[model samples]
Target: MKTVAAIALYSFREAVRNKILYSILFFAILLILLSVVLGSASVHQDSRFLLDIGLFSINLFGDIIAIFLGITSVFQEIERKTLYNVLSKPIDRATYFLGKFGGIAMTLAVQLLLMAAALSATLLLRGGSVDLQLLGAFWLTYVESVMIASFALFCGSFSTPYVSGFITLGVWLIGRLVQELAAFLDKVEEPASRHLLQGIVALAPDLNFFTITTQLTYGYPVGLAYFGAVTLYGLGYIVVAMGAAIFIFRRRDFI
Candidate 1:
């Protein structure tokens, strides 16, 4: 456990030092700040506009960061031939994978908070309170990003970083549009084809479960129980995905 923690801290430090991460975070905060100007254009709904823009900025860039970290974390190690040395230590492959994922998750959570805080601060400037719905929405998005991170790590375990990033982003897009895919499922008349599509959708992460944008936008209520459920779901998905990544990593011949 200490070994994993050590590796995780190392990874967190390494990731935070990446110039690209800071660049992306800067843009994300910039977009949120831009909301202040854009929000003013709308008459009497500056808060709502800011909310919309801020949420969009955080969620979009958060996913990008998640994918970026997952793709680069282990791949960089292998590329620099450091993975061989790391694996040569007493730690098993599973420990290394878990540590990497933990570090990625930690880095993402911190970045999410930074973005979320920027949004909240902007909202306060616009006379909007940092309400529960907004927080819930942000939490859900982070949960969604965490799932994507785990999935990208799993992909990077077997494929090149380019392929892993592409596949991860593709899956994320499909997952986000899961509602549209479900509506299309009703259009299919053939049972076999419909079932196949259904299976694919079922196997895919239900990102819609984490979406509360409409509710947040409209000032609808979101309960604590729902937040608990969503949090648990995200944690569960990460565990399963990390297990698969470890399974694949263990089988790889890194010689």
Candidate 2:
């Protein structure tokens, strides 16, 4: 536990030092600023556009963090031979895996907060007021980002950073389309093929549950049960991804 916490703190510091973190922040701020211009273009997306802009910023930047930071976490250590050095200590593989996951999760939380604040500022300036449910909506988005980070970490365990990043991105895309694909499959006449698609749907992460940006933009109530279920699902996926990362890392040759 001590090792996990210590490593997590160290990883967090490293993540902060990485230039990409700041770059993403800059881009997020840019998005917030542009929201005004974007909102003015189309009332459908802009007048109440702060929420959508903010949610999009979080989702886009969160994805950047997952791909850039999460995928490189372990591979960077291995490239520098730090993984071997760390493992030589009293630390176990699981602690190392969990530490990376914890550190990235913490980083996502910080990023989410910054994005939310920026979004709120834009909304305030635009003469818009956020409902309380907006907070829950943002939290759900953050949770989803953490889940993506975990899956990215798992891919990083055995693959190159590029491969891991691409795989994580693919998973995110698949999760987004899983429901749509299922519906499409149901309309198809090929029973066997449709059933195969159904199986994939069951395995894919239900990303739609995390995407409440539409509701936020239109000021819809996000039910407590829905939020709880989404949170539970995100945590469950995070655990599974982290566990897989540990399993793969245990067999990794860092020498």
Candidate 3:
């Protein structure tokens, strides 16, 4: 427990010190501000339009941070020989991996909160009423980003940072389209190919579950059941990805 906490703290500090973190954050704030400006052009109920833009901007920027930093977390440590020094201590591979994951998760949470604050301020300025659904949407967005972060970490455990980045982005795009792919596969004439496509879609993550943008924007009810299911799904994927990362890292030779 002590080892995990210590490592997590160190990782958090390292992530905070990175220039990429601040650069993305700056751009995210800019996006939130820009959303407010664009919202003024709406002809009807400009508050709804502004609120939607604010929430979506935050979610989009948070995702960009997760992909940029999460993919490099482990890979950067390994590349810089920092992993060797850390491993030379009393820490185990699984503990280290979990700590790194925790650190990245915390980093993402901080970024999301910052974005949320910016969004809130933007909405308030536009005379929009704050809705609890927006908060729920933010929570769901965070889960989705964390899921992507775990995938990136899994890839980084065995591949170069550049490769992991590309793979993570590709998987994210595919995850959002998995349902569409499944539907298309069902319509295919060939049985064997259809079955193969079905199998592939099943293996892919269903990112749509985490998407609540349209719902929050339109004042739709985001029920608790969907939140529960998405949370569980995110946990399941994170566990699988972290397990794979640890398995690879345990056998890595840093000599």
Candidate 4:
């Protein structure tokens, strides 16, 4: 546990130092601020429009940051020939992998918090109030980013960071449109095609479940029960991805 904790802290510091993280975060905040300007153009739906755009900006950038950190966490070490030194320590491979993902999760949390704060401040400046509905959306967005990070770690186990990041980003894009895939399933005329698509969709996580932005924009809050369900789903997916990452990393040759 202590080993994991130490590695996690080290990884967090390293992740924070990545200049790309700051660049993306700066743009995310700028978009959040832009939402306010754009919202003013709406006749009576400025709040709704602003909330939607603001949350969308935060979630989209958060996921990208997750992918970047998660995919590179392992590969960067190898690139610098530092993995050899780290592995020479008493750290177990599985423990080290968890620590990397934990660190990425921590970094993402900080990123999201900053964006959320910015969004809230922007709202306040626009004569709007932060509400529990917004918080719920933020919570789900955090969980979604963490889950994607775990998946990215799993992908990084056997591939270069660039390949892993592409794979992770592709999967994330598809998963975000899980609902559309489901809708398209019925349009397939062939039974085999339908079944294959259905199976693929089943394997992909429904990212829509992690989103409550529409409801928030409509002034409705999701119940605690809904939050529990999605949180459980996210945690379950994280466990599966992390376990796979550990399994793959143990057999990975760092040379």
Candidate 5:
């Protein structure tokens, strides 16, 4: 546990020093601020527009940081031959993998907190009130980002960084549309194709379930039961992905 914590802290420090991470965070905050300006153009719907833009900025930028950093975390270590030194140490592959993931997750949590704070401040300035529902929406967004980070880690475990990034992005895109794809599959006349599509859809993540920005914006009722279910789903996927990554990393031969 101590070793894992050390590695996690190392990863956190490394990620903090990444210029790209700062650049992306800067732009995300800039967009959140720009939302205020854009929202002001609307007469009565300014608050709604501002909330929408702020939430979207957080979600979009958070995902970008997760995917980029997650894909490269282990791969960069291997490419630079730093992984060999780490592996030669007392730490096992599973602990190392978990530490790396925990570090990235920690980084995402910090960035998400900042963005959520910005959103709340923006809302307060606009005469809009912050409530539990709004915070719940941000929590779900963080859940989605965590799931994406795990997916990226899994991809990076067995493939080159570029390929991992592509596959991670593909998974995200497909996951977002999994429900629509399932509906389309049901309409297909061909039985074989329908079954194939069904199998694919079953394996894909249900990201649509995490999206509650519209409900948050409109002040719609998002039940606690539903939120708990989606949070569990995201956490389940993260566990599965991390498990696979550890298994793969243990067996991988860095020649």
Candidate 6:
């Protein structure tokens, strides 16, 4: 456990030095400021528009950072031959994998907090208040990003960084649209095709379940039950993804 913690801290510092993370974060803040500007132009529904755009910007940029960092976490080490040195030490393969995952997750959590703070400041400046529902929305967004990070880690364990990034991005896009895909599957007349779609739906992460932007924008009430259900779902998927990553990493020959 101590070794895992050390590696995790190292990973966190390594990720902090990545220029791409800052680039995405800059754009995220820029977009949030732009939302404030655009929101001011509207006579009515300004707050709604600002909150919607701000939340979307946070989610989008956070996912980008998560995916990029997760894919490169292992690949960068291998490319630099540092992975061999680390593996030669007392650390077990599972510990190394978990450390990397923890580092990336920690980095995402920090980034999410920053973005959420910016969003809150923007809302306050616009005469809006941060309520429990708004905080819940941000919490769910962070959870969603964490899930993406885990998926990226799973892909990185077995594939090159480029291929891993592509696969992770594809999964993310599909995960977000899984509901629409399921709807289309329901219209399929062929048994085999329907079955395949059903399989995809069952296997894919239901990202829509994490989405609360619409309700937040419209000031609708979000139930605690909904949050609990999605939180459990996200945690379950994250565990599976991380376990798969550890399993694959243990089998790989670093030599």
Q: Tell me the lDDT of model 6 at 220.
A: 88
* Tens-digit per-residue lDDT, 23-99, candidate 5: 99999999989988998898899889988898889998999999998999999999999999999988789999999
lDDT of each: 0.90, 0.84, 0.83, 0.91, 0.91, 0.91
TM-score of each: 0.96, 0.93, 0.94, 0.97, 0.96, 0.97
Model 5 TM-score?
A: 0.96
Total backbone collisions, model 5: 0
Q: Model 5: which residue pairs collide?
A: none
Off by over 4 Å in 3: 190-192
lDDT of 4 by residue, 165-252 (tens): 9899888988989899989987899999999888979999999999898888887768999998999999999999999999989998
lDDT of 4 at 82: 85
**Candidate 1: regions farther than 4 A off:** 190-192
Residue range 54-95, candidate 6, lDDT tens digits: 999999999999899889999999989999989999878999
List model 2 lDDT by residue over 80-190, tens digit each: 987777888888889988888888877888888888888877787777776678788788888888998988898999898989988999889889898888878858788
> lDDT value for candidate 5?
0.91
List clash counts for every candidate, in order: 0, 1, 0, 0, 0, 0
lDDT tens per residue, model 1, 117-193:
99998889879989778888988989888899999999999999999999999889888887788889999999999
